[model samples]
Target: MRHLIRRVALAAALLAPAMPALAQETLRLRMNGDVNTLDPISTTNFTVRNAAYLMFDTLYAMDETYQPQPQMAEGTEISEDGLTYTITLRDGLMFHDGSPVTAADAVASLERWGSVDGLGQTLFSKMESIEATDDRTLVIQLAEPWGLVLDALGKISSNVPVIMPAEQAATPASEAVQEPIGSGPYRLVPEEWVPGSVVVFEKFEDYVPRDEPPSMAAGGKIAHFDRVEAIYIPDTATAINALIAGEIDWIEEVPADMLRYFDGVDTAEAVAARQSGNSMQLVVNHLNPPFDDPLVRQALQLAVSQDDFLLAAYGDGEDRYLKCAAVFFCNGPYATDVNTDRVLERDPEAAQALLDEAGYDGTPVMLMHVSDIPTHDAYYAVLKPMLEEAGFTVEVQPSDWATVATRRASKEPVADGGWNVFFTGWGFVDQSNPMTNVYVSGACDDAWFGWACSDELQQLREDFAVAETEEERMALAEEMQRLTHDLVSYVPLGQAFPSVGIATDLEGYIESPVPFFWNLQRVE
Candidate 1:
């Protein structure tokens, strides 16, 4: 049995090609969605985030144990009272553009990121000021002591705290950035980019990997290939075929339906190399009608079924899917069933009563459905009529995941290109901790997509941050979960654990929650 990474992953069944082994130089792989916005702070999609992980470096990164490890920072100095933190940049750090990374660059990067990412907003609320005290040093004066500051800085999720050149990082969070500059081992090759087809990257010769061995998103981010090309192959058959024919070296994700195609294929080996992860969320825009009424939100929550969604998405099985009953995650360390009693019960009659009581006047729910992910189809198929049965009019809007990423940002009314509901997922890593969870932040307009806000949610998160003991934190987590149910933050459909196919000849693939490109090398 091969050593697989992460807590749980799909038995990707093993992967690679039938072609003769060759030295790894330029690795070729493909994925489902197109990289939306390279501007790290502007978007939150798996495609863009995975690419950003390659092109950019952060102040801190997560090790295998999920602890914060210094990436570009020499070390962090905190005042005893925890009211102040001074971070000094690692010496000789240089961006892909050959510009020296300075303390000012990191300050601006954090500022811009805070304007968008949910965790960043939390940090901003506690921050009195964050400025460069010297070329190599950043001094953070907090309004109060916060324990998750480093965790926020080291957030490994999308809208990640990817440090950039001060000028580039200065781009307004509302606007998409044109440049993709960073200090990571791989430099994104812009000219080779094709809008929806291919993205090319070349290794940076000047990159300085840390001395320690690579682990998770930290340590030495040694790039073993001279070039890496990610070709968007939305069709699983095409992607798998490419892998089998040696036309492609790896496929980031192999859809559940395609797993059968790999059975007994000598050259193909799919491994469940990561954890059983990601939740399909039925997001209702709180900024608009229907969803604005907690009663209506509760109605929708009652009508839908997680089992129906999961069966359609991953097929009926315990291995392919997990019955997640909580807003955080189903079975993880901090998973709780705070307010999921109603959610777990599929009651159309009760949902109708709630909607009728809310005076919902048949307002059309602009359900923005994603066409990319194979499982998303199951989401739309399961949700449309259930909402209609519960006294809500459903308008199905169709598009790729990239379009969903942009349109979800709209705060407009449903009639004016705004969205009422949509489908998306988050790695459990983004949720387990109350303070780190993006969906539960309740930062109002600054919240992820739907812009859900609640005073109770915010207060709970703040308290969760300062919590010192495991018992206390877990108790707070339950309260936060309870609050999440009350606010109807977002309806979590279920957990879908998919696997990826990689070349059996390749080595140094680290098992992580997300797609990682560093530390891989080709061998015969």
Candidate 2:
């Protein structure tokens, strides 16, 4: 029935006259939510990170083959002891304000970012010092050898290591920058900036792109469009309509079920923009009651069925999603299923027994639901019923993602405006390994959102970090997975490759975990 309605609407929409093109080349994109901040260091929100990809450039980036390549740096030299790393900056790098990018800016930016980012903190923990010896040269002295030095700098997702002006980078990591300044291909139009409605960016004429062909977030970032508009439209149907009518050029996230509507349409095409996709997860507050008990957390994990959540969110396309038990990404190295039978079993009877054994007395679990995003709302729809059937008192707290992002930070009880559980998605890059994966950290008070504390897990991560051989790392990773299941740090629902809809006339789309706008071009 849904397909029939979409088919009819799409046919009629195709018959309508096409809208005239703008005088200036402009790409209007549909954003999931409002981009309140351009400061990448302060938050790990996807929307902001997506926008940041265009507004800022990284020193190093992951290429199509997943190997790190220097972007801003001309080259790097390492000492025989593996302690000293000297990097030379490429020439012609200038910020939006027409100021040349320098090594001092990189040092200050890294210092502030390392204070907050999950991977940065780990990398900085073993660091001795970072200094800019000259205008175009910077040096880093490490206390010990580390494997993920490039990985931490070249990470392609949330809390991205984006460069900024020295003065702006000097701002405390706790506070967001009031203004965003970078040497990327695009510059934010401050005069046209609107928090919720829309945000505008213009191509930087003085910006010099790399000579190499664009690959993932590396190489060239050629901005084909003169202007780019990230327009926020909460309604999925309305956003789709806008795309079909030529009112918008790209829909960042296209629901899996609606991909069929563009089957024979000439105006638009649906592409799997993110090849690796995101790992959808259900995170719980370890500090809160019921969840504070490991038994209760184990029970909740037992109640979940990855298939139910994936089907509800992504429809019946096998290519769209995957059901895997690995805490680290299922496709990557060190992926393991040890002790994941608890998640795969999905026996309601067993879940009830665990809940009973845990002495759960119908404590109302606060599940935060985000209605603005279609996929998230679908996951919420299936999740609430599963909890109820599993012998738990569930209270559905409906709200936007911004509210959930802010509320999840509170360590207070649910009765005191704190939340118990919420669903979020992490890109494969963010979950590929123990060091890069933020949610797996068992740093207690210093851990990411959930605050799950386990010295055993921490020790395993520490061991995994410095493991000399791949076999040793794999063995340590397997142990960590086993401990993760035992501790029920968080539930990994499933993995999904989300589709993006774009105008058929638009070309040069780069397929990556995160979408990029630089090389995209419009065809007449």
Candidate 3:
């Protein structure tokens, strides 16, 4: 598999004859996952969403500072009541298919999202209604005041909401996934999808660039890469080797342990970005025994030493820990203070006392992790011993990533009848609002550990949504975080930092919290 990935990487580096060299410099980014679909609504997986972001445009976008910026919408005006918002559209914007982008298109795009079956329906469900006044103006009426509506739209999941041609969306969902279209820098060429091989994006020269800056952009050139290629190279070792060999210009999701090997390689430049909102933590199923008691959860949190896990997984580097307070480091709105002094110090004796007091006397516990994420395995290897020393029988179950996700979704008890603890990561649309991703009970189907819903937490989250000011919202968020910390639903493990290996020659490549390939543009 490694050898096969190396060959694909090499093939991608050689400029293809089919594309014109004069079109502009094309940067081929070799990634670890498959770019199988152009349909953004089909899946919220980062891999798929990252590609759609390059191929589509949303009403709002996030700038480098993680602030909301306008995209397709020229500007948005909110009424004093804050219930009605009027958005003016940028003029002359056209889809890849050359159709003029209009308020009708925007309304259609939003309506599709409002569908319960849509990938982003959860986000737009709060909208009261959308009305199109003209080709370039949209009016959205909300049920109540939503201060973060623009911020919410700028989310990678929401901002890049795929704009499907009304004609195509009329087709069945199955066909839409196969023949996806959008208004972005590139168009999907289905012929490029070779079985288990490369998926190519052909440049759309007639593509309309947004006249108004996206809500996120202060000011700059729009997307510069004329064409983008996403070649799948599944093996991390081979991906690194390809970068060193100059067979591939860049590789995302670099393995933590192997970062040292490419330290001074002339062809490779190690671009370290704050972890892409990927977080690894231990979740305790509250419905099950042992973990059913908050005290038991607290005992487990105290027993596992975060320092040992960080050292074992990242080998003593500051980059291993995100400075932000959110589960994922770079993107959240609030700045998090890493309580290193408190987090690193393990209190096993105290943990034992807590467990004993809670009536947990050497009860066997199950520790589950997906085998695909190498870091999770490293975490468990270090954590198991700490937990065992605290008088807990630790059983480890490693399985495929998909199977683990299915199990989590089923909300079924682990195969050993029930699991006291499990390891998993939570993915968010953006970093600014960490509360919704981690603590908001119903946001991601269920709580992190499938814990029973809390009425108080739900009320707090609602308060956060309607907060008129940042101070009020943050105060509520802090309270919510404290509640989760006190309840001990899961141990707040360190966030994952994204390590990118790029060719030094590449310029204008800014590292975003949600690492996307389109964010890079060759400067030379």
Model 3: lDDT to the true structure: 0.62
lDDT of each: 0.79, 0.84, 0.62
> What are the per-residue Cα lDDT tens digits for candidate 3 across 100-154?
8888877777666545232234446557888889888888888877666776565
Index of the highest-TM-score prediction = 2
Cα deviation in Å at residue 364, candidate 3?
7.6
Per-residue lDDT of model 2, residues 310-344, tens digit only = 98988778888889878888988878889998887
- Can you tell me which runs of candidate 2 are displaced by over 4 Å? 1-24
- The residue-by-residue lDDT of candidate 1 on 331-449, one tens digit each, is 77788777788778889999999988999898888777777667776688788888887778888877787787788788998888888888878887876666667777887876878
Name the candidate that leads on lDDT.
Answer: 2
Ranking by lDDT: 2, 1, 3
Clashing pairs in 2: none
Off by over 4 Å in 1: 1-24
TM-score of each: 0.92, 0.93, 0.77
Which residue pairs clash in candidate 1?
8-274, 8-275, 10-272, 12-270, 12-271, 13-269, 13-270, 14-269, 14-270, 15-269
Predicted candidate 1: what Cα RMSD to the true structure?
5.6
